[model samples]
Target: MESVSRDLDMPDDSNPLRRLSLEQLRRRTSMKWRTYPHDVLPLWVAEMDVPLAEPVAEAITDAVALGDTGYPAGTAYAEALAEFAHKWWGWGGLAVGRTAIVPDVMLGIVEMLKLVSSPGDPVIVNCPVYPPFYQFVGNLDRPVVEAPLGPDLRIEFAALENAFRSAGRGSARGAALGAARGANRPVYLLCSPHNPTGTVHTAAELTRIAHLAREYGVRVVVDEIHAPIVAAGASFVPFLSVPGAENGLSLMSASKAWNLAGLKAALAIAGPEAADDLARIPEEVSHGPSHVGVIAHTAALRDGGDWLDALLRGLDDNRRLLASLLAEHLPSIGYAPAQGTFLAWLDCRDLGLGSDPAEAFLKRGRVALSSGRAFGTGGEGFVRLNLAASPEVITEAVRRMASAVV
Candidate 1:
């Protein structure tokens, strides 16, 4: 294990401050992976096994040392976050005002739903997506219209338009009546650089979507949690960056990239009309961010870019290793190229482990992964593998997977 100086400004892999043992690492991981048996290696959860940036660690320690673990007070974090977003992702210098903070990205989406939608109002969701997309919309009793994703696991805009038009009718008989009423009643819930399958929609793709949504005046809420993890060559276009997306709201987070999920801090950003709806989300949700989380998140946004770069590089390596392993040893499993994020989509249909390959892998191969069926109907015979662990761990996972299938 690498050591550090415990300095807020230092890198995670800098000169030695201490060393950690394999046993210690396993023990810590076991505490978090409580659902799995002791021998099972967990690659199911999205959290990274790597240590956080030095600044984030130092911030947490300092927060604890100073007894600053009280409830969140002012908007120090929001202001810092605004600068971070403007600098990091090149958002048109949008100021991260006090309204930026939310409990998490999921809550941000939920609040937006509450503010924009009435009961039974239709909301569009692409299939084989994050499971929470279903839960959040369902919990509100909102009627969800499924826009089945393309083979590439990207939103099919044409299909979305068709679904939106048909949703209000509810039945074949009602379809004619609803069409005559001509109400555009659905809002699209887009997962940018989508979870499970990591496909970053092109700028051209986004523009067309914006134009389509603008024509119907349907709201577009984009989950951009994986924006920061985009590799160097690929560009991550914010929905609001497109010409016709003046009303789009983008939900972003440091949690996905910085491993701050435990902190539960994320941002809800919007353009003019969208901002009006999103701004109505209560400050109480903003206050849900704990002091420790604020300290860690602020430190990560303000001073942890180098660490983030290293982490991205590591994920890239792991992605390549996993792909190579699948091709060489587990050829039956297919993986498409991932543009960003640490998750990989594995097509494990040929293994004959039934529809949910992840569960089978866990029980038989001692490798825990996310079941594909959990995403939606199209996700059958697939699984989502989180590649945020050490390279050795990923390689070992492949070995076990290969042996089990053979």
Candidate 2:
């Protein structure tokens, strides 16, 4: 393990993320850095190469010094999240009482689904979505119905309504589900500031979705883990913030925005009308979060705004940097430019690299990016680029990607 500084000195430029070099990044054994060969530049995962924000690091270190690493406890983590939500998103009345701690965002989504649907019940999702949406919902024995994204990479309401209607009309799981319960209802899993593509659903769009979800008896569960990372000029709309959305559930965390994935903590926030359903989650599920993870996440919410602001500036620079890098190295590649998160969904179909373009880039150019096909339908001939690195790394990754095509 590369040692975390006991005392961090804010760098002269004050962008701690930009200070990391290729060699320094390689010294750590995190999955993102160590998964690929030494020669390969790995940008396939969501992990950021940034160092910990001082306040978060200090909180963890303080716990370590005091031997406070016991099983997770307390409402501090959830309360911290509520505070952050209120301050940044202007989300008032976020009752921490209606929230619960979970292992992470994905796991929380899994538990939330259980509250709304039964095994074999139809669950609706938008694709190309985060790949795990399929895996986790399927793991629960629920059938996932895809509502393909529109050509503009935004939600297609017509497609979504079709899926919801089919789900309401019932499917293979309908009879069994209906027989088990008096009536059968489905769950709609939404990804706000959606993964890979980085489209932040507008408040009006979300309100429409909420009305539709209520009309169709579909419970909505939004994965808002990327809520804190929207670009400077863009705005992120929290699902439950919209009118008529009080029955939906939202999952959020500091892990994604703060580069603390390995810490293992997240929150599942419930809308006012959804509190009863949230309370249905088994108490044992709360045990999954790491005690120290809560401490670190709390500190991030309470005291790491300056560091987060700095990292955001660095990431904004990298997003623009990735744009020019693509233009110079592979003008043929199609990119919409991400407005949220450090992810870029690039169109590689024109490159004629077949279904899995990342393979060629890895084998030929020694650059590793996430393959598009795995994200589901409409992802064919595309790649998800990570824009959470230094400008030089982003430049080099694209250069190598262009080289791979030749």
Candidate 3:
């Protein structure tokens, strides 16, 4: 691992995705690298194929050198996020007072749900979203209601309105929670720059959502972990920055952009109207983040801008590269260049792979990808490919996938 790091210690302007060799990546034991046989090209999970940003690596190293491993404390993580948001997304409204540090984005979401809802109450989601949105919400005993995205992979207001109304309908669970919380409002768990498809919601779309949530008496909680991974010509609109969203909540982190997922830490931010509810999150939840995770996240938000820019450049190139490769070798597969996040959602129905093309790719092509079936409704006959690897590897993966069909 140390040798791999040394090989990847390139200038900030260089493409980090191309720094490490395939042999070096094989040395990794992370779920992404170790889940398949050595011959398979792994492009399934959210993990990035890059080394740590210099500032993030240094921060973690310095903390360990000083033996400063202790429980997380202070608001440095929130403050750093505020600065980053203000500079990058033009979001100057991130209130540190309204933020709480949680173990990770999913856990923070679970905690937030508890504040505005009860078990068995329906929690709405844009279908074919992150698989964990279903797993975690269901585990909490809260039923998930699908408001599947439109054919364009963008939110369909009519579908969302239908979900909100359906979730608001009287039920044993809804009546119970309504009586206690003063209203039987459902919670919409939105995935901005949505997973698999990578659709970045426009500000107008978000403002419309906020209006609908208000009209329908619904609560909105967003996972903005991919906020920083957006490509050029597109912008990320922070949910809390738009009008009518003063009651919405969002979870943000530097973990995704900086490849610091193993170091678990994320901030749950409340809108001005939702601060009291956010405060109700159990005090013990604050203790869940690692001191090291906080330090690394803060450093990444505060000083890793250059490294992140380099990564976005590499990912932009890779997205275009994947499009061309598919057009050349696997023209039957449907794909749109992702607007954000290093993931590609492929329409494989045309390939006759029957529901999950990823299975065929892994078995016949020795390439591992995420099965779209796992993403829920509207995900059938699709697959998700990770685009955060070297151009060479991405090209090879496309060749392998094409060969699978042949």
lDDT: which candidate is best? 3
**Ten residues in sequence with the least summed lDDT for candidate 1:** 1-10
Q: Where does model 2 exceed 4 Å of error?
A: 1-13, 169-181
Listed in order, each prediction's TM-score against the native is: 0.88, 0.94, 0.95
* Per-residue lDDT value at 82 in model 2: 78
RMSD of each: 5.2, 4.1, 3.5
Order of models, best TM-score first:
3, 2, 1
- Cα lDDT tens digits, model 2, 210-309, are 9877666678999999999988888888999999889899998899899999999999988999999999999999899999999999999999989888
Query: What is the TM-score of candidate 2?
Result: 0.94
- Model 3: how far residue 309 lies from native, Å: 0.6
Please give the clash total of every predicted structure, in order.
Answer: 0, 0, 0
lDDT of 3 by residue, 200-286 (tens): 999999999998887667889999999999988999999999999999999998888999999999999999999999989999999
Worst 10 residues of 3 by lDDT: 1-10
Among these predicted structures, which one has the highest TM-score? Answer: 3
Error of 1 at 305 (Å): 0.1
Query: Which residue pairs does candidate 2 place in steric collision?
Result: none
Which stretches in model 1 have alpha-carbon errors above 4 Å?
A: 1-22, 29-32, 168-185
